[model samples]
Target: MTTLETPVPAGHRSLRQRAGNAGRRTTSDKVFNAVLTIAMVIAMVPLFVIIGYVTYRGIGVIGWDFFTLEEPPYRRAGGGYVAGFFGTLYIMGLAILMAVPLGIATAIYVVEYGQGKLAMAIRFFSDVMTGIPSIFVGLFVYGLMVSGWISVGFGTFVAAVAIAIIMLPIVTRSAEEMLKLVPDEWRNASYGLGAGKAQTILKTVLPAAAPGLITGSMLAIARGIGETAPLILTALGSVFIVTTLQGDPQAAVPLQIYNGARQPFEEGLNRAFGGALSLFVLVLIMVVAARIIGARANKRK
Candidate 1:
């Protein structure tokens, strides 16, 4: 024992070399982190600026009448966004009813059962649909439902359909991604337990992706409500809120805001800002609620 010693390996790095390399890596990490943080801040600047300006202009315009009464004429000042507000709710509700189920179902087909040309075509068309401009969708609906084609004329139901077109792609894509995130092990386990394909999908896969599906649906709803072009061509904008699915044109927040902004009166401009603010608040509430629900669902899972 006093004389015997093992020879050192030729390629073994010394402690000092390893320490220096680790320090260099840590420094590189810090540099990358700082750069990414700066990039994030830069990206956020415009959003913050727009929010601040909108809030400043809109805060003083909110009154009880501003929210509860019919929007006033361009030169008039005592009315509210009541009609458009309700119209937005009605249209958004119908659109959600029409879109979410179809989107989720399409997502399921693509993720679980789709194969070969069918699946490829679905994914291609979904991406294509996402890129289709809102105005084009409006035009198509107008041509089909409003013009001599179907003669449905301007109705909230048609408007809801137009919005649904805009929302479908978003919901489908989001849901597909979410469903894909569920662990394959879970599916294997379910099958291992003798579960049928439909049973496993319904009982295991969907539950795992529920939070994301819900969140994505909420976001799609938000976008649908704010769609002005589709509504213009389909809903056609009413002076008063129409409560029925088939009726005289329905008013919506976006239509009102757009008209207000284009009017030649200070009152109209102010009202436009107020409408924008209200829409912002409503969307914020929905998004926040979605986040809360998603968090809870994730925890439960």
Candidate 2:
């Protein structure tokens, strides 16, 4: 016996079709997600490999003496990068002092007060400056200061200036973005409270964006600290610890690494690796500290 089936309702058929499409979409999403996950893992492999290799090669050389003693002579087996470590800190500190304030000021003008051709020009130049080669910056500083014709001479101060120039654009762009992230309502509220534009920006906007500003500054510092070419031309590298900025050549970790890597000796190679590891550790510490400070600032907010 043949049975006659009733026609399905249009709504029911549409509902079934919709469910089918939804299932297919879900499957496609899963497939894409899996592909992306695999891509991400592949990308991370090189970073992990480099870190592991550096640690393997350098960890054996690191010790209390590495942190306490001056770099050993070429024939010496046991020496340290004490001068380089502190010099790195000193130069970076000076660079940060110069760059952060100017960068923040530029960002403030761009985000808060900038609205004309001049602002656009500033942004355009900043972007261009960000991509300029480090070596070129070194060359510029070398001619402007280290050439002796200008009478500035090669020293820690000139090196700091070069690094600061490299750092300025990064800080400015990052700070501008951070300032943009602050809600307009906060500014409005400050204004509603009879605060002037300057007061509003200083009290409301800056405080609100402090965490991001710190993060950006840290990024700039990270970029500047690793620069060796500029230091080569400007600081001119020293064997002994020279902390004073008074026209005296300085020893920085990057310069130490560069010099060590060029040497044919095994000890020099080992020192290079150790310097790399030290630099990596220093940057990691700074990043972590910045994160902690940002988190605390967020909590206060």
Candidate 3:
């Protein structure tokens, strides 16, 4: 027997067509994701290789004395990089003291109160500074503070200043971006509560962006700490462990690594490997700390 049926509506046909398109989109998304995963794995290959090679070459050199003794005489095998480690910390601490507050202040002004040519100029120069090579920055500082008649001479303080200059733009740009991420609603709420501009920024905007600020600052420090050329020109590395900031040269891991790499002896080469490994570990620790702090701040929020 023949059966009669109602014609399908245009809406139903369109819905079927949409479902087909959705299915195609799902396939495409999966393909793209797989490609991205492969690319990420490929990119990480070099990092793992480097870390493995360095660990293999340098692990034997790391011990209790490695962290407590200074570099030995030329071509000698029994010594450590205690001086470089401590000097790196000292210079970095000083540089952070000089740069972080100024960078944060500059970001605050640029975001909260800046409105004209001056603000634009500050931003323009900051971007320009970021691209300037470390060697050139070293030269600039050398000319400004070391070479001319008005010289304070090469020392830890001078090196700290140079690193601070290198760090300022990174910190400023990072902080500016973080500050920009803060919502206008938070500021409005603060204003509604009879808070002044300073109070609103301190209590609302800054706390809201604290995680990003810490991460950015830590990353900036990482970049500055790895700089060799600037420290070479400004610090004039010392063999002995120097504690004071002025009138004496300082030791740093990068300088030690550079010097060690130049030596033709096996001991020096081993020291270079050890320094490289130590530096990598230091940076890794800083990055991990930044992640933890950021996570805690997020949870608190």
Candidate 4:
């Protein structure tokens, strides 16, 4: 070897260390990884078990008649949740109609136009709203509707108001975060091109953040779908299919599942499992569809 080559010291590593040393795992690392894997498995076990159980039990109740006819008596051999199905769609649609505009406007104001005490106060209230119990929302809506503010009966419209309240804070917070994530460069470029604030927000800022906004709104809607307490108080579940927005009690999938699961008959239990599985599948479909639409929106941008 040339003089440039250093002699190896006894029991010392060459230069830094061997390739084996670089790839070697420590005991702590192994222990931590094992713990993490165990925790993940534990967390996932309940979800997988519930899905499997519901799928196994509910499959028999899923067919054309199950979705076409109103639920039968609990003592009957067979029933369906179609009434609850339409009620759910009606409530969700109304909630969306009420929430999206207000939520997006709040988000835009928070992110672009205002970041002072007012914005902080809005954010604080939204966080508090998010943490409030669903039952409280139900109570508030019940009192409000009963106080002669709204002209509708105990049905989807009132339930929709409750759900919209639930979704508003979520959408505002989520959309604000997404809007804030949009790079400042886009705004700067718009300003540099002599675009006014309104033009920039409408033409540039919102378009860039459309995908995240869509996803956040859809997530808020999904969250609203699973809440039973508000529907119980406001909609007051009915077995009859409700085609009108108001004038009668309405059935929702969450309320249907809640009522079905508590009955003493096989019919109710079957309907419960079916309702649970159907609700899960419906939410899953919404999520999947939103993701696809969001992906396409992002790509288009």
**Candidate 3 vs candidate 4: which has greater TM-score?**
3
Q: Model 4: which residue pairs collide? A: none
**Window of ten residues with lowest summed lDDT in model 4:** 16-25
RMSD per prediction, one decimal? Answer: 3.2, 4.3, 3.3, 3.8
Which candidate should be chosen as best, given lDDT against the real structure? 3
Residue-by-residue lDDT tens digits, candidate 4, 1-301: 6478677889986865656645456766888999999999999999999999999988889888888888888868676888889899889999999998899999999999896999999999999999999999998998879345764558778999999999999999989988997889999999999999999999998988888899889989988998999998899998877877776898898988899898898888888898889989988987887789778876775
lDDT of 3 by residue, 1-301 (tens): 9898667876666433466478889999999999999999999999899999999988889888888888997589969999999999999999999999999999999999998998999999999999999999999888888876559888899999999999999999999998998989999999999999999999999989989999989989989999999999999898788988787889999999999999899888887898899899889899899889878876876
lDDT tens digits by residue: candidate 2, 31-146: 99999999999999999999998898888889999989888875567788998888888898899999999999999999999999999999999999999999999999898888
The 10 consecutive residues of candidate 3 with the worst lDDT sum are 11-20
Error of 3 at 219 (Å): 1.0
The residue-level lDDT of candidate 2 at 87 comes to 85
Candidate 4 regions exceeding 4 Å error are: 1-25, 147-153, 289-301
Candidate 2 lDDT: 0.89
- Looking at model 2, residue 157 earns an lDDT score of 88
TM-score of each: 0.88, 0.89, 0.90, 0.88
TM-score of 4: 0.88
Off-target runs (Cα >4 Å) in candidate 1 are: 1-8, 14-39, 295-301
The number of residue pairs in model 3 that clash at the backbone is 0
